[model samples]
Target: MTQATLSADRSDANANANAGAAAGALRRIGAHLAPWLAPLAILLAWEFAARSGVLSTRVLPEPLAVVKAAWSLIQSGEMWADVKVSTWRAVSGFTIGGGIGLVLGLATGLFKPAEIALDSTVQMVRNIPALAMIPLVILWFGIEEQAKVFLVALGVFFPIYVNTFHGVRSVDANLGRARKARRRRRPARHPHHVSGRASAAVEERAAKRDARPRPQCPRRCARRAR
Candidate 1:
């Protein structure tokens, strides 16, 4: 082929590759953005409704108004201070309550006797609404920082306890059976058999399994697929 013709063909091939890449990238971007469409539509409708005088600004402000207020707070430094205080409170309460819940959850999950003894009492406490405790809490703790922290801790406790308990309970029966079968097949684990490489492999497998996305409900899966 002539040099000019060869160069033209090479340029055409490069252009085609670039166009293909750009089209693929756009498709990927659209796929990522598809889920956000519903929320964006809702926001637009809300702003339009507020602007059209159908909704009172006092009762339900415009989305833009809310954004402006947030920006104002950010400029005034109040937002940062509020965030700092709330974060400190949440972390303090969560740490204290979650620590206790973890201990209790493990104890109850592992021991049937502990579950029988403590589970009923914990369930009863959980049944009582946090709002109902306000008067009693005020009477005893007198609306101090301790009372606020206690309320936050109480709010934080139940979810942590429930999840921890379920997580311990969710240990696969098949895994236990498999372990027993292996033990029976080889009555003793030799030092060579229990090598660092084998242990590391098991741990890495576990980490990857844990990192994998969990199965969603049928409806959610369908929605996401769309």
Candidate 2:
């Protein structure tokens, strides 16, 4: 081929390769972004529909109005206070209830005799819905904040108690057996996995040996085989 012609062909090939790479990259980006497209389209449609009077503007305010109201609440600091108080209540209840449940559950769960003794009563209490107990709780603890906290704790305790009791009672025997087997196998553990690798090395060595011709078998064994 002529030098200039060869150079022109190489430049054409390089340009095609760059274009193909760019197309591949664009396809990958589209694949990654595909999931968000439907949600964004729906949101846009909903906003336009609400604004265009196809939907009730009062009930389904435009996204802009919702954003404005949220911004106003934030500027006035009501949103922050509300978030703080609610978060405090939730975290307090979770900590108190979760701790109480874990301790009681572990006690009942770890002991079979205790499980038999306490399981029925706890299960009965759990069957009664928390909302139903509100009246009784109000009468006993009043409407003070402690009443709410106690209710939250009680709400979390029963499921943990019953589940823990049953879990300990019904644990698999094979797990214990497996633990014992592991203890027995602890020695020479290196040999277990390494044996396979060692066998692979031996096979490779045998392949190398077989590649070359070997001396013939002894006459007596060869005759018997024949």
Candidate 3:
């Protein structure tokens, strides 16, 4: 074969391989999507059946009827007012609560003494449901909007704090080893495996006496960092 024909043959093989990989991925996605599709299809069928009176709209409203109810609520100014009030409360609470969680998480991640002292208790308390706290929050802050905000803020705090605390307490034991290794060799590279292994090996070996021994290092170095 001519060199160009050989190259074209290799490209066609690569294209076929890529096509097979894509087909495999598409099949997996379709498998995952199948279960969800059944209920969705049923809902559409129900909606069409209800509108046509194969099912009675009188007994159960057609999908469009439900939409009309929702649309009418939207058309009326009252729905917007309620929405605005709820949005205001949720935004205020989410912002304040999420901020507190992030700060506490960062603090906990950074400090070991803080993590050991506080995290066990925090984890234990996180099991308590937020709904259970609503009564206590109301008692402390009253039925005012502040009560909701307080409840949400407390709800947001502990888990984030513990996660942050643990993150800060761990890692960096391998940093020096990594730095020294950079002077000798990288992990055994598979140059023939990549695009340009031949030229790279020639250039690297020609200049250096790869005569230096690589330092003794353990694969488990990352374990010590924590």
Candidate 4:
């Protein structure tokens, strides 16, 4: 083939490859954005309805209006103050609830007597809705920060308790057997060493449970290879 013809063919091939790459990138972008399409459409419809007077501002304000109000609150420092108070209440509640739950869960999971005494009561309380206690909470704590904190604590308590109890209970039976065997072999060994080993095993199990495999993007991988 002539050199000019060969060069022309090479340029055409390069252009085709570039176009294919741009198309692939667009497809990937569209795929990523697909999940947001419905929400975006809804927002657009809401905005159009509000502007067209189909929806009353009194009943439902425009999204832009809400954004503006939030911005105003932020500028006035009211938003940050409210956020600080709310964060404090939530953290206080979670700390109080989570501490009790962890201690009780460990006790009940490890000792049969503690389980028999506490588990039934805890299960019964867990079945009761947090809303059910609202009247009593109001009467006892009144309309103060304490009431809000108590409600938060009540909401936080059960999940922590249940998860901790189950996690401790779910420790491998083989590990427990191994611990016992080790104690029998070495009668003079410190008890803390065995307990530390058990704790390590629990931590390892939790780490494994929380370790998730990240998904690879094919486009990114192909680009990296090139």
lDDT-sorted candidate list, best first: 4, 1, 2, 3
The residue ranges of model 2 lying beyond 4 angstroms of the native Cα positions read 117-226
**Residue 212, candidate 4: how far off, in angstroms?**
63
Model 4 scores worst on lDDT over the 10 consecutive residues at 184-193
lDDT digits (tens) for residues 53-167 of candidate 1? 9889999999999999999999999999999988888888888888889999999988899999998999899999999999999998997777877888898888888888889
Q: What is the alpha-carbon lDDT of model 2 when measured against the actual structure?
A: 0.83
Q: Tally clashes: model 3.
A: 6
Indicate the residue-level lDDT of 114 in model 1: 92
In the order shown, what is each candidate's alpha-carbon RMSD?
24.5, 12.4, 20.4, 22.8
Q: How does model 3 score by TM-score?
A: 0.49
lDDT of 2 at 49: 95
CA deviation > 4 Å runs, candidate 4: 179-226
Which model is ahead, 1 or 3, in terms of lDDT? 1
Report the number of the highest-lDDT candidate: 4
Reference-based TM-score of each model: 0.64, 0.55, 0.49, 0.75
- Candidate 2 vs candidate 4, lDDT winner: 4
Clashing pairs in 4: none
Residue-wise lDDT of candidate 2 within 1-226, one digit each (tens)?
Answer: 9999999999999999999999999999999999999989988998999988998987888887899999999999999998897777677777887776676678777776766787678778888978899999999989987787778778767666667666775888799899999988886586877998999999999999989987666997889989
In model 1, what is the error at residue 210, expressed in angstroms? 59
lDDT values, one for every candidate? 0.91, 0.83, 0.76, 0.94
Task: Tell me which residue pairs clash in candidate 2.
Answer: none
